[model samples]
Target: MGTADGDGLREFYSAQQPRLVGVVSLLTGSRAEAEDIVQEAFVRLVPRWGKVSRYDAPEAWVRLVAVRLAANRHRDRSRLTGLFHRLPREQAAPDPAEAYGGDLEQALAGLPMPTRQVVVLYYVCDLSVAQVADTLGIAEGTVKSRLARGREALGAALRSDDHA
Candidate 1:
């Protein structure tokens, strides 16, 4: 790529990286994992920057990649869990509620990954249902259903927390 192309990619990365990390973190429920996922997405984007930069919303490409990576990682982790015994680590991890430090974040974390992805992409990213469906490669109807379920679940969780 030319110097101008490199400069444009750098500027895009600077502007979009933090926001993408936040979106991925909400999707993955771990800031550390989100960082890694987002970074890898950008790495993958490097070669495609020439083409992707011309797109109306290049960030969407990166976000889609990061989301898919997070989903793949979750699936791999689940499969590995079936094959191996998990050993207790020496370090005690912080409670997710405390780590996230917000009732909404805790509630989102409680959601099933699929529901959480739809909720985060639609609400947090402010993407339209069609956009979300496109990003996730699902039907718009599926996105709508997931959003409905997510809203109900989040509402109940927040209500219960309020009562406690």
Candidate 2:
């Protein structure tokens, strides 16, 4: 790419990286893993920057790629778990919520992957249903359904936490 294209890509990365990482972290339930996934998404985007920069919403593309990567990682983990049953597992560190004393974060972490993606994309990323549908390559109705179910699950999780 030319210097101008490189500069544009840099600017885009600077503007979008934090939000993308936040979205991915919520989806993956691991801030460190989210950062890695988002970085890889940007790396993939760099080669297509010339075309991506012209999109009406390039951030949507980045979000889509990150979500897919997280899904793939989950699938790979599942497969590996089945294959390596004898291997001792390394424990993940304490939840990131411990740092902020945020029950909502923990509640969100409990959501199913598809529901969580819809919630994060709609509420956290502030995308519309159509945008999220496009990002996830699902029907708009599917996005709405996930959003409704996700909201109900999150509400129940938070309420239970409060009573506890």
Candidate 3:
């Protein structure tokens, strides 16, 4: 990267690292793991920092990278230890109980991966339907369907949890 690009990335990292670490930590359920994920993400992003800076949300790019790294880290742990980072994700989702039991995250975790990805991309990432479709290499219709199904499943899961 050029000197200008390097400076830009440094500035971006300085601005975003705290939020990135907090989100990564919440997602990974480990502060140390969060730090590792953030580092890995910044490393992966360094070479492409210029490209990333052109995006409307450079922080989003970093966040996506960090989350992916955390996922990969969990996958590696599973291979080495026969289990890793498999915490019931929904349960780990920040408490609605503590934050006001809105939608149960545990139920959302039960959805199929594609559906979950679409939902998070749209809802959490605030990406447009087209953006999500492009990111997942699927049609917009597919993105919509997955999102709908995911919402339905999450709703059902939360209801079931309540009844139980």
- The alpha-carbon lDDT assigned to residue 135 of candidate 1 equals 94
Better of 2 and 3 by TM-score: 2
Total clashing pairs for each candidate: 0, 0, 4
Residue 3 C-alpha lDDT in model 2: 95
**Top-down TM-score ranking:** 1, 2, 3
TM-score leader: 1
Clash pairs for candidate 2: none
Each model's Cα RMSD? 3.5, 3.9, 6.7
**Clashes in model 1: which pairs?**
none
Higher TM-score: candidate 1 or 2? 1
CA deviation > 4 Å runs, candidate 2: 81-102
Over 31-76, each residue of candidate 1 has an lDDT whose tens digit, in order, gives 9999999999999999999999999999999999999999899789
Error of 1 at 49 (Å): 0.4
- Please provide, for model 3 over 40-141, each residue's C-alpha lDDT reduced to its tens digit, 9 standing for 90 to 100: 889989888878899987777787777667667756754754332355656444433243343444454455556766776687667899987876678999
lDDT of 2 by residue, 16-128 (tens): 99988988888887899999999999999999999999998888788889999998897786576566655555544343445433366667777777788889989988989
